[model samples]
Target: MTASLELPDRLAAYLQRSGVALAVSVCEGDAPLMFVNDAFTKLTGYTEDEVKGRNCRFLQGEGTSEEQRQPLHDFVHGLGEDSGRFPILNYRKDGSEFLNYVFMSRIRDSSDAVRYIIASQFDMTNAMQRSKIRQNDETLRTVLSDVEQMGREYGLAMMSSAQQLADSVAMMARLSLRDTR
Candidate 1:
């Protein structure tokens, strides 16, 4: 509520009520933050007024590696993949640092134009609840998504038997990659 947010009632309600720290940024310009929930403020020691309209990179000061930043940067620039997930060291407003696992998804409009990047970030330093289970779940989701993509590409090259068989596996990978939601 610290910033003037314009969103649908349902989306606003969900963002406000989410337990996980979440932030949303518009795709244009410096990708300035547009929305941050109370959980985000609590996790970063910054209130809405201080964080809104700023880039999330404010959380990075020293020790945040270029290796970790490159993947995310590529995602934003359309240089590599369509999504980004990585762990990086992030600083809080109080100068304290934490290992942050960031997951970002691009929200595309009906016409397939990306309008926003919604980020879900978690502080790994404090997360201790059966991470194996969570990791497994995430792995499965990634595999399924890959399988879905494989299928789409496979359908185009089913002419040769050996090629078809090889593509079938890739096509399977594509199908498995689908159903991201």
Candidate 2:
């Protein structure tokens, strides 16, 4: 086999053997699926044939906001040379949403002409979930601390005000009682 085929073949074989879920695409004029192993199909429920000639954007749906689309467009256009990463939430064919961390770069031939745009996607839903949990925990901790501090300050203010009121009442009662006696 030619080296071009051999390397990608070996890499695809290794990835399949390792059971890593990933999807790879190459884009020249239009994005095309160059290789997708069993894991990719298993993750997205799309057969290799179904995705071969399609742009990856079809995975997006009405739920996909412009906010998610603009950055990828900017990255692909801004870099010009061809390499960048953007994280996006995308839906599977079954409409299940997952966080995808996508890395894209251009592969150049010997003459350094712009050849292929290679993209690799990693499923980051679990990592993002963990990060969200940690952020929430930190936010809760800060709020609790603020509440505790406010409680202490409020308690001290109430005590000081009560003490002054009690002392004034006691003095008035003593003067009035003494004057009456």
User: Candidates' lDDT values, in order?
Assistant: 0.64, 0.52
- Over 1-181, each residue of candidate 1 has an lDDT whose tens digit, in order, gives 2222244444556556655577877777777888888988998999998987888889997889999787777766555544557788999999999888876766554446665667767678755668854863464354334434444554642333222332333233233323222
Worst window of 10 by summed lDDT in candidate 2 = 158-167
Global CA lDDT computed for model 2? 0.52
Instruction: In angstroms, give how far residue 115 of model 1 lies from its true place.
Output: 0.3
Best by TM-score: 1
For candidate 2, write residues 41-120 as lDDT tens digits.
Answer: 77677888888667678777777778888877665443543556667888887989888766565544444444344454
lDDT measured at residue 65 in model 1 versus the true structure, 0 to 100: 95
Model 2: residues >4 Å from true position, as ranges? Answer: 1-8, 11-18, 75-81, 128-181
> Model 1: runs farther than 4 Å from truth?
1-5, 126-181
